[model samples]
Target chain A: EAGVTQSPTHLIKTRGQQATLRCSPISGHTSVYWYQQALGLGLQFLLWYDEGEERNRGNFPPRFSGRQFPNYSSELNVNALELEDSALYLCASSLVYEQYFGPGTRLTVT
Target chain B: EDQVTQSPEALRLQEGESSSLNCSYTVSGLRGLFWYRQDPGKGPEFLFTLYSAGEEKEKERLKATLTKKESFLHITAPKPEDSATYLCAVQAVFHAGKSTFGDGTTLTVKP
Candidate 1:
């Protein structure tokens, strides 16, 4: 089976702009999770989506939001992006316990 | 509130040398603990999952064990390819929807 896939392997956006990152879950997977790994920092949870519903989110601000489609694909949108938003955005897919991650999208905010 | 911490921010070892990385956690209602391997400029790859205390899992040269307060990833006769950051995360049984993760330990193995 194909693993989790993400689009735009690398992205560059200016400050105050809006950035959109996409994730397509593996076949037969229903849950998609978004995480951000800042430079020299650990992975921080962003959002969780299951069956096209927003399930849970982390302590991040409301500017970081996302949605899951019926097909189990997800899109993470960051409005008013700041320089700190430059990080590797990862997406994982899971059915019950273990989560399989994608290659990740490297976002650079200038 | 749940918290996770890892010891030895970074470690360097020689090929064939064995060592262990620690992941200490404090959370209510332990559900499961997960181990992952992450390489530079890449995403984390799933390694193993432990459900309860005293549980153990192994793959290749790596073995993961879980206890009430901590988890350990032991590398037996590691290789240079095993050099990567190892991450540990835990989720509460009541709230498996989300998880708490440690900062992770970076391991570098030299030939």
Candidate 2:
């Protein structure tokens, strides 16, 4: 079975612009999570979606939002992207306890 | 709040050297503790998941053990290919499916 897959691989946007990253979870997985890994800053949880519902979120600002699709795929949207938003955005899908991560999309804000 | 801390920010060892990385965590109720290996510019590869204290799992040359407050990833006779960052995360029962991850330990196995 294929692991989680992410789209765009990399994204570039100017400050104040909006960016969107997509992720497709493994088959049979229902929980999708988003994380941001900045340089020096460890992986920080952004959002969690289960069965197409927003389950939980992290301490990130309101500009960070996402939604899970019916098929378990997810999209993370960052509004008014700031230079500090330049980081690797990772997506993971879990069946129960363990989570499998995607390659992640590297977002760069200029 | 759930939190995770990994020690020895970075480690370097000989090709045949054996060492263990540590992960300490604090949570309301630990649902599970996870270990993952990540290569540069790539996604993390699942290594092991320990659900409770005293639980142990092994794969190839890597063995993972969990305690009530921490987890250990023991690498036996590690090879250069084992060089990568090891990440530790924990899921809390109160948070449902959410997980908190540590900064990770960067390991370099010299050949």
Candidate 3:
């Protein structure tokens, strides 16, 4: 079986621009999660989507939003990006308690 | 609010030396704790999951043990390949799918 897959291995965006990242969960997995791995900041939870519904979110602002699709794939959107938003965005798909992550999309905002 | 903390931001050991990393957490209701190994510029790789205290899991030279307040990742006869950041995360029963993670412990094993 294939693992989680994410699009755009690397992304470069400017301040005030919007960026969208995508994720495709593994087969038979319905729970998808998004996380921000900022340098030195650790892996911070961003959003969780289960069965096409937004489950829970972290302490991040509203600019960070995402959605899950019918097929269990997901997308993360960042509006009015800031320089501090430059970080690796990771998408993970889970089966109950066990979770697996994708290679991550490196977002660099100038 | 739930909190997770990992000790000794960094660790360096010889190929045959053994050591342990620590992860301490405080949550209203502990549902489960997870361990992940992450290489530079890569996503975290799942290692183990411990749901209750006194539970233990092992893979190769790495062993993970859980307790009420903390978890320890013990590395024995580690190789340079074991060098990477080890992350600890916890899920609170109240928070549902949200997981609180620590900054992580970066380990470096010399040949």
User: Each prediction's Cα lDDT score?
Assistant: 0.93, 0.93, 0.95
Candidate 3 residue-wise lDDT, A55-82, digit = tens: 8999899999999988999999999999
Best by TM-score: 3
Tens-place lDDT digits, model 1, residues A54-73: 98889999999999988899
| TM-score of chain A in every predicted structure | 0.99, 0.98, 0.98
List the candidate 2 regions with Cα displacement exceeding 4 Å.
none
Off by over 4 Å in 1: none
Residue A11, model 1, lDDT: 95
Candidate 3, residues B3-100: lDDT per residue as tens digits? Answer: 99998899999999999999999999899999999999999999999999999999999999999999999999999999999999999999988888
TM-score of chain B of each: 0.97, 0.98, 0.98
Model 2, A5-83: lDDT tens per residue?
Answer: 9999999999999999999999999999898999877888899999999988899999999898888899999999999
Worst 10 residues of 1 chain B by lDDT: B91-100
- What's the alpha carbon RMSD for model 3? 0.7
Write model 1 residue lDDT over B37-111, tens digit each, in one string. Answer: 999998899999999899999999999999999999999999999999999998887665687789999999999
lDDT of 2 by residue, B3-97 (tens): 89999899999999999999999999888899999999888889998999999999999999999999999999999999999999999999877
* Residue B74 Cα positional deviation in candidate 3, in Å, after optimal superposition: 0.6
Q: List the residue pairs that clash in candidate 3.
A: none
By DockQ, the better pick of 1 and 2 is: 2
Error of 2 at B111 (Å): 0.9
